[model samples]
Target: MPVRKLLLGVLTLCYPVAIYFGLQHWSPRVMALALVALALLRALTSRQAGWRLLAVAAAVLAAIVAASNHALPLKLYPVLVNAAMLGLFGWSLRHPPSLVERLARLREPDLPPSGVAYTRRVTQAWCVFFVCNGTVAALTAVLASDRIWALYNGGIAYGLIGAMFAGEWLVRQRVMARGRHG
Candidate 1:
């Protein structure tokens, strides 16, 4: 990957961890401004219009809320990220190619008919996962303590996503093998 892309990917991956630990001393306004700057810079550089625009808007909203009430934005960051992901996935489902289908096309341009169906189903699964995960994060923010919220959204959430990716890869391998044999 290009250095810029790699840096962005690393930053995105480390977001929850940074938020979880940084909240102890950093003001949410500062973090939110940083996020807004990054998001706007990314949007300016992005070739795609859809997600980059949404990300910019979300970041601006985060900054606005953070400026007014630091605690609120800190609590809502995970929820907003997951909710945005859910929206992106759900919206893709309504269009010609779901997100998974588009991604599958990247690797398997002429994916089999069954593979197409599998990708669609996988996309749906991800949509559901995001919805449920976002709900849990929201609840944790509202009903539980900050530490509990951080633990769930920052640590448990990533673990669940990793497990999901591993499980999906295993299943996809089995299915593709079966298709080859049958």
Candidate 2:
């Protein structure tokens, strides 16, 4: 499991540059095949049934399209993923125990009212971030060059996410400290 996590981390870090150059140097068909294989392996190994099923279905659909010799726009992958994340987070907002609250509960099962409010706000922030990220991804796919698309999707997006995570942690720490004192 550690090895898998390490590999995924490395792959994610390298994905943008790799895909950008990959599209330039290799045929789309080859890239599509490789991506499908990786997706299938991930799906087969996934612990969640829903994710496994979704991944399998997506892989099968991509495979069928590949077999038919249609060039699956490589740019669409990240766009679709961002859009899905937006939907997931947005959907969670409408349901009780929003996504951030669930994650917060994992750390503090008996979360305070203040903590619950904080998590809900954080969840809403994340939902907004997803929507903007997905919009950028879609625009890049439609209007930008391949290199530009890859750079934004790969490097810029990850950088923004890391910054957001760090910012949230800092805020949460301050909130918790204030709550304890009060």
Candidate achieving the largest TM-score: 2
10 residues in a row with least lDDT, candidate 2: 68-77
lDDT of 2 at 82: 69
Models 1 onward score TM values of 0.84, 0.85
Q: Model 2 TM-score? A: 0.85
Off by over 4 Å in 2: 57-72
User: lDDT by residue for model 1 over 1-182, one digit each (tens)?
Assistant: 67887887677666666766776777777667656765776676678776586566668667675768556565676787788788888998999588999999999899888888999999999998998999998899888877888788778999999998999999999998999898
lDDT by residue for model 2 (7-109), tens? 7557645655676788777776667765576567667566866556546655764676567544345556666666667767777889878889999899899
- In angstroms, give how far residue 169 of model 2 lies from its true place: 1.2
- The Cα error of candidate 2 at residue 54, in Å, is 4.5
lDDT of 2: 0.75
